[model samples]
Target chain A: MDTNPLDNASPGHGPVVALFVTCLADLLRPSVAFNSIKLLEQTGCRVVVPLQQTCCGQPAYNSGDYESIIPLAKQLIAALEPADYVVIPSGSCAGMICHHYPQLLDGDWRDRALQVAAKTFEITSFLSDILPIKRGHRAAIKLPSVTYHDSCAGLRELGIKEQPRQLLQELCDTELSELPQTEVCCGFGGTFCAKMPEISAKMVHDKVHSAQTTGATILAGGDLGCLLNIAGRARREGVDLEVRHITELLCGDLDGPAIGEGE
Target chain B: MEQHSDTFLENASKALGNKAQADIRDLLGLFTPLLRNAAVDNFEHFEALRHHVKRVRQHSLDNLDHYLATYEQQALKNGNRVHFANSGDDLNSIVLDICQQHNAQRIAKGKSMITEETGLNDFLQRANLDVMETDLGEYIIQQAGETPSHIVGPALHKSADEVRQLFLQKHDLGERELDNTEDIVGEARQILREHFLKAQVGIIGANALVAEDGYSMLVTNEGNGDLCANLPPVLIICTSVERILPRAEDATAMLRLLVRSATGQSQTCYTSFYSGPRREQDVDGPLETHIVLLDNRRTEILASDYREMLQCIRCGACLNHCPIYNSVGGHAYGSVYMGPMGSVLTPLLSSLEESNALPNACTSCGRCAEVCPAEIPLPDLLRDLRHQETVEKITAPRWRIGLKLHTWLARNPRLYHWLTGVGIHLLHLAGRKRGSFRKLPLAGGWTSQRDFPTPQGKTFMQQYRAQRKQS
Candidate 1:
């Protein structure tokens, strides 16, 4: 059952997308990429995975190494050229490519960056916006209580806090407790975690503690970096829980992942 | 202790490391959910109120000079003397001069960050005037001889035991044990009561100065602001220029957002409007009122890239929701302003050069912006400031050079990937068996606290393209 409204790429309504498998989806989490494809393709849009796409330069840009970020940015701009829209799964990556990258390439591709930016939508937003297809859950899978952590980028930069949750509500008949500090950062701020270890450790610990208190068996969010941070801390603390991206659960492809299973 | 705009960031950061900041951050994280839930459930009119507050702030910013003048005129018409300060030094002098002219010896102050900005207490203490903070939190920190950590809850960092000890040390009590929150409040109230009644000048911060009313709307949970503004013979208001609103009703929209967003209170227990000096037959109010509009780099901020920073209502929601502030906390930023707003304002009020650490303290998370009733684009503003820091060449030299090198390679992905892949391969080889490294030389911070996982056999991009080709 193709739940995606983007299953058919009608130029009249379907968007030609520059697929941005954000830095995390590109480096750390690959299935989020495959899951992203199934989700986007199901929606009826033409997804183009530009091979020239590299890091959106968020790591460098955030580290105040803007100069180092510019060229990577220019390369990405050139790779996704002529796409009517650019779709990304991760909010942090989407935020970087859509929000910060354009500012870096202000002189040459400023207009192009701005143009691509306007059309760039997160996969969940694309599902909610361009797709809006009725969600078809893969067989009824019962789960214990869970809550959604609104990634800062997805919530603030993209206003994607609700769309994923709205979509997730249909996936299973599970207890959903809105995360207490859902809007607060789980502290995976690219290099910030490295720059300030004590602070980062304490913050991740607190986030895990708060999530645990909700009595939810599963914690989910959009960005993998934050999920990894929370999941790592949850495992380190030996809390009984599973952490997964909203997409993996939305696709019902999530399996065999205990906290810190891969790491 | 003259305030230095330059030392804002370094001071803030160091202060945040005082160990107390962590405790405060933990506490703040706990209390924050309360406000966020209230904001979301306003199911009644949260969005409308958010829009209303945003519109009010926008209106105030555009017609600022006009509103300030209107507030001044209204205040003067109500027999309040209005003086403007272009800098902290000017504000301090105006306050001191007012105190001196009025023969003020002992003063009582409510919680006023602007007074802290002016270093007014230190200034008054230097001149041999006995100054006391009447707010319970302010009084606690005053006794502890520390600056206020959180804006709304100044003594929020201090635990009950610490306060018990501070109160015991400050007062000659044989066995008056501060058992709970109510006891602490009672003790502080009793101590500050005389000061409030007998002080020559009672100073307070105005939440919103209504331009049409010639009055100041001062909000406080304890009603201390009213006492501070009304008790003494000469009452003075030390506030920044942006506190002025178009009318009393305009503030209703903001007040609707402010209290609800601040402490989750539908309305604070006490909301008082003080027009001016007491009328002839008034039972008990100040004989004279003074309005000190403290600019102190605000005009420059208005002229600079940070004009929107003026829209802050000082509700401290940003501090509560800020992850950086939650982790490092406010004191680490070292500037008087801490949290998200401090990261932006500290540089402006202080110096961009000295406060370079402040702007970089953010994760560019939108939590602060989302929770902010004022709807200030805090993350965007922080990024813009960082950009300004880069363009202005105020950032550390190493960062600039590193950025230069990164830009050079990143322009060519093949080269960038080759270099990173080689580096990645070396790291993977170095930590293969363990699947993660507890410590890596280059990223010592990651190693210091936790492990960094080796990028498995292939990066996601590598697998992504291969999978795409197969399809």
Candidate 2:
């Protein structure tokens, strides 16, 4: 049973895509959004960046402020309603839209939320599942070997384990040294990082250590929050690792410094 | 024993600082899951069995009243007395009253988390009753006068060297260099063997109580439970009300999940079913048997939104897979129940106000739900507890206020972008040199541990708008 509605999506006709540029990607790393736009465009999609889009309300949702997330969910639904497909750069935010929106809203808003959720896809999943990039004999782009972090929400909530890996292996020429315990969270769990910093620190340190053990100079993941946490810790610990979003490498946006690196 | 769940962060900090224990926790976090995975993989029908057992548990919980009545009737017919304790105090008093009724001087106990929850050992000890733990792990923690850290392995936090020291100091049996693991076991066995024989009553916990037959099922690697049930003249099985199953097959079916999930084994060394007291043909068993079913707010949980938690088989798979539990270990949870299940169950068992920190301690990795044989949505349950905290204003006012401010800003996208754009651009300019900040005001929690990466120039929304205008 092909349960996924987006499984048969065709990109040759240039479907309209509304990019839900997550708050972290919007503020912490704008290039993730730009690169995501480029990737979507390359797949014959007319990508639209909705200006009305803000945060996905995961901070409020995760912190147990269900009252606050309702309005945010409605606003996001309204803002991104017109698109044929709503795309996101990060998995956690996409998870919020896909998994949690209906959980947080009610009645007609829930129906709208569900409609939007069905159309929403994380960038890698969007590429691989809906509008897969046509393969060619193009040479692999020059980059250091990388390891991938499976962001928790995407991997667990949406079953996004192989989509990104498959896409990265197909698109990026760099060797992907699979991270040990890649399924474990890097501990940038929204407000959890701020509230439980000591535990989060230990968790991120473990994740960074695991990535280091892979001996991959570059650590890449589909989500910006995890990359930022890993990159921040690696920099603080004086470990020479270039942390990047998969889109950055796939789109050849190497002009900017790696996460937590100087211009 | 004590509810320090409110101080979870502090305890976690202390646990992390204790490098030796934290390393053990890290190893446990790594290895326990691997072991469980191997067991699950070895079983061809693990997934099917997991679902089957989950349905059986849900059915049992759903028809709890009917099953409880049936179990009680069957148990009474089998010559066993059934007692329902409304609270921890009720259960402790009931057990004490039973011990006093027999004029029991020495009591041998098997590993019973229900007893732990009710603080039965401390209660009985306070009454000046000679109570001894029979399970090796329980005996170790009992000797140390400390609560069980891990439910399955109570003294898991203790090093073998510490156990040797404990045995040397506590065991009066003239020990000559108890160096090897076998010698230590033999010495403990030699001492516990006396207590087993002399004890007037044996107290153990049931893994499941079958309604169809009056038999209470228990599984253990140590066989101490069977010894505790049979050796003493009187036996008491202390377990939660949720442990009831419709039939013996249901009990065995659950065992298939529980054993694999707990120790990653096909079966424990011992799986015993106590029908009642000693029968006419039975050579050795307790003369009188009693089953104490502790309610302890479980009925309320069964009625509430968190009823799915009742399906938990106490496998500790959640604890093995939890990142938070991995980082801080079970003791840091500061509850009788620890790890993901503990976090969800502790608050429901106690007041959420006192244990709000337990729910908030989670990173919501959802691994617990993934590995749970009962299929409990542990992360969602934890999140709901946090929701209750918010609704009741149990969380700090500042945290609520911060959430409110962010929510309000998020609802208005333009203002959100404008405010965030200015802040991010300023941060980009400030930390553009270093590419991150070592220290920042109001971000002490984050900066204290790791650097905060600087934003990449203008916010994406701002850049997107600018690009749109240019085009």
Root-mean-square deviation of each candidate, in angstroms? 4.9, 3.5
User: lDDT tens digits, residues B1-471, model 1?
Assistant: 223335544444454566765665667677775765666586488887787877887788888888888888878989988998988889888888989998889999998999987889998899999999988888888888888777888877788888987888888757876888788778888888978889999889888889888787888898888888877888888888888888888777778778877788888888988888889888888898889888887778888768889889988888887776766555556657888888888888877777776777777777788778888889878877787788888876666676576566656656665666566556546655654555557667665655555554456655544564586
DockQ values per model:
0.35, 0.59
Q: In candidate 2, which residue pairs get closer than 3 Å at backbone N, Cα or C atoms, i.e. clash?
A: none
User: DockQ for model 2?
Assistant: 0.59
Model 1, A100-182: lDDT tens digits are 87767766589878877888888888778766746565554466677888787777777786787667665566788876666
The best candidate in terms of TM-score: 2
Query: Scored by CA lDDT, what does every candidate get?
Result: 0.75, 0.88
**Candidate 2 — which residues are off by over 4 angstroms?**
A1-13, A135-137, B1-3
CA lDDT of B337 in candidate 1? 81
lDDT by residue for model 2 over B428-460, one digit each (tens)?
999998999999887887888889998889988
Instruction: List, residue by residue over A1-263, the lDDT tens digit for candidate 2.
Output: 32332333334567888888888889999889888878888788977776667888888889898988887888778878888999998888989899898888889988998999999999889899999974467766677888889999889988999997788778777788888887788888878998999999999999888888998978888888888888989988998889999999887677889999988
Scored against the true structure, residue B329 in model 2 reaches a CA lDDT of 81
